[model samples]
Target: MSRITALTPDQVPAESKSTLDAFTKNIGFTPNMMTAFAKSPIAFNAWATLLGSMSKALDVKTRDSIGLAVSEVNGCNYCLTVHSFTAEHMAKLPADEIILARKGHATEPKRDAAVQFAKKVIETRGNVGDADLKAVRDAGYTDANIMEIVALVAMYSLTNFFNNVFDHEKDFPAVTPAGAI
Candidate 1:
């Protein structure tokens, strides 16, 4: 059971209702995380705005890669499962690649750099060393891309922390972490 009540669209505060409805229209259902976030209108709106803007910053695969890597490192199963579904379906990443991303890797060199950077950001709490910054830039990412990568790390970290605290029931297909029985 979730520590926080996951609000339905009608049950959410008036300010959050439109956001939930938009989610329903776009995705065919409001994600559990969004519904849980609806419990606080300020949080829900902030998340929606940040996520909407960030979606344009990176390619879908890279975004999902960052989400997967961060969620795995944070041990947030709710985010892991949701991002796994998006990575495979929406982002069109292969299943094997999705698994690799969850482990903070990618077969593609540039993507691997992004995933590794995201993992390191979480592990070091954003106090990355100079070499870490160089690795990502050396992989062909521009300064803007690096900033986006950091923003994605921050974005996914927020959701991961929220899910970890609430233990919200996952509405998506379950994805066991690599090495889990």
Candidate 2:
């Protein structure tokens, strides 16, 4: 059970109505997280903007990989389930790759670098050493990619922390943690 109650569209603040509608129209239903976020319009709007902006940053596979890595590191089952579903259905990443990403690994070498870098950002709280920086650069990621990777990590970390704190009920199909069945 969720620690907080999820708001329906009619129950949410007026400012959050449009954003909630968009989510409903796009995904065919409002995510429980969005409903929970609706308790504060400022948080809802800010999160919507952050997610929209970051959607353009990296390829689907890379973005999903970062989400999976961050979610796993944060131990956010809610985010892990949502991202695992998106990674497979929307991003077309194979099941094996999705599992690897959740484990903070990647099959593709370049993507592996991004995943590892994201994991480091979470584990070290953005205090990565020189070698960590060089590894992604050596894998052919430009400065812009590096910045976006950091941004992605920050964004996912916010959601992970939110869901973990709230213990939000999972709306999507459940996903086990990386090592579990």
Candidate 3:
């Protein structure tokens, strides 16, 4: 593995120029994980697009559950940090609820179903049996809702797995000591 270097604008390839520029303007900086990923713009673009589409399609409730489940399973420090915050802050999920979801003990009927279904999706590698599908449907998720979960798992899995393999460090400096990721 190459020594993972922090990417500065001077290091970005031409292919990554526009995307990183747009990202810097929005978030105040290009995310370090993405800057590392921009080494291959195709992969970076794929990651960006997949995460965006999945984010737009997912219900906030389902997204938090899925985020907790996949991050736990992947043991991805970077994702666990960001998604936990997003789950708590953006999704407005209670901290206790996210804790429960991480432990597979979420009590809310819909959320428990989402977490369980997401765990099964990762464990089964998309060969998720009918029983799992039936359970999610019974939990009040429509087929479209369930499909959004499939996309969520796949997209997060890509980033989670990448972060692990590439030694991608956390982007946000503010949360490092908590070890939440």
Top-scoring candidate (lDDT)? 2
Task: For candidate 2, write residues 69-130 as lDDT tens digits.
Answer: 99988888999888988898889999889889987889999999999999999989999999
Error of 2 at 43 (Å): 0.8
lDDT for model 3 comes to: 0.75
Tell me each candidate's TM-score: 0.94, 0.94, 0.82
- Report the backbone clash tally of model 3: 1
Residues 1-181 of candidate 1 have per-residue lDDT tens digits of: 8898766546889998888889878777778888888888899899999999999987889899989998988889998888898888789999899888988999989999999998999989989999999999999999999999999999998998999999888788988853461
lDDT of 3 by residue, 1-181 (tens): 3348867778888987777777677667667777888889898777777766776775786777677778777777677767777777678888777766666546778778878988888877888889989998998988888888788888888887887787665665333221242
Candidate 3 global TM-score: 0.82
Q: State residue 96's C-alpha deviation in candidate 1, in Å.
A: 0.6
Clashes of each: 0, 0, 1
Report the C-alpha displacement of residue 150, candidate 1, in angstroms. Answer: 0.6
Off by over 4 Å in 1: 178-181
Score candidate 1 by TM-score against the native: 0.94
Report lDDT (Cα) of residue 50, candidate 2: 96
Ranking by lDDT: 2, 1, 3
Candidate 2 stretches with Cα past 4 Å from truth are 178-181
> Highest TM-score, which number?
2
Model 2 lDDT on a 0 to 1 scale: 0.89
Error of 1 at 89 (Å): 1.5
